[model samples]
Target: MHLSLVTSVLLTFAVFWNQIEYQQLIGSWQLTHFEGMEKIVNSSQYQNASAAEKAGMDARINYRLENTVYQFEEGDLLKFTDLENQTVVQKEAKIEIKEGNMLLIHEERGDRLAKIVEFSDDKMVLQPISKNSVSGKLIFERIKK
Candidate 1:
């Protein structure tokens, strides 16, 4: 009887711990991607562009995932801010958690930006819905407080 009670307690603790770990990811994250010099040089646009133009374009593409504070008035929005351009774009929609993935819908500029998020440990991969181009995946690591 004592062995069974101990086992039950351990199981309960394990479940509770998992819930806490999942909740820790409910915060903001900064996103970045570094392309190799070879890839950049081989691209037609980059090949024709001057050094300063290439650098400026690369800077503008970096962004941040700002999920720290959500607003109900903005239709349950999640914001992604462009660090280089200092632009804050709000994604107006609802976020739903299903199974182990997060689903979000944002309708703006006549285009819907749907995303699926999968997280483990301190890392998350966000894949956005795309039509012609291949799906773009943004990998993010949780920022420490």
Candidate 2:
């Protein structure tokens, strides 16, 4: 009886751990700079810009992670709509899960861009990478409802 009880406890713990890990990625997040407490906000120019202009603006604004709407879809994919124009940016690429984090890689023309996602209790950071260098960083916070 004691052996059965111990096995049940261990199994329960394992299940709980898995559940928590999954939940960690199942909410809203914001991107902010690593140096300061400033929350990255989208600018107005993106809203009125053309597609080409919007593409250029991509490197300037931060991003928000919407994990609740799209979960477990491939490529560790999360929805990130541009805050200024409300356009979906990373919808085409496949997202991947690495270690305990999420990654999104997309190709535009010949340039390859990557987004490294990191999350905490209240915020998430989306750092954009190009040519193996960080182009910009976006910090997002959970939207309370």
Candidate 3:
């Protein structure tokens, strides 16, 4: 009985903790790094790649370019900015927590499950699953309250 009570309390605590963490994401975040694409683009392997492969890689990299910012609004609306094209795309998404460490973002584009590698008030590191099932790391810093 004692162990059961302790387990119940722990579950409750975790729920509250996750609520706070989820709320923190309801703000602006700017992309600071994309190690996955950057490493491939800068490495010697890129030089040997065929033109088509290069183009495909470039297109994927384009979506996660530096200076990109994402604003998560209160009503599940996400405003994403692409600095290179100076374009802003808005989509409604539902954020769901999967297994405590992953966040599932369901939107018009598709459902994306991102692993939270590191998260704090000022910074976040997420690894989102790409179209080809490849995972890409994205680092971001808070830009607005």
Which structure among the candidates has the greatest lDDT? 3
Provide TM-scores for the models.
0.53, 0.40, 0.63
* Pairwise TM-score winner, candidates 1 and 2: 1
What lDDT tens digits, residue by residue, belong to model 1 across residues 87-141? 5644454444343344444445444453435567566666765676655577676
RMSD of each: 7.7, 10.8, 5.4
**Residue by residue across 1-145, what tens digits does model 2's lDDT show?**
9999999999888655543244465554544444221222244555677888876544543333332123223334455434335555434334444433435444244434434455566666656556665455666666654
By TM-score, the better pick of 2 and 3 is 3
* lDDT by residue (tens digit), candidate 3, 1-145: 9999999999988866754356778888988778776678887878788999889878766766654787877765666764435455444577766665687888676787888878889998888866787766889999864
Report every candidate's CA lDDT: 0.52, 0.48, 0.75
Q: Which segments of candidate 3 are over 4 A away from where they belong? A: 1-20, 45-64, 82-88
Q: Candidate 2: which stretches are off by over 4 Å?
A: 1-22, 31-77, 83-93, 100-102, 105-118
| Superior candidate under lDDT, 1 versus 2 | 1
The TM-score leader among the candidates is 3
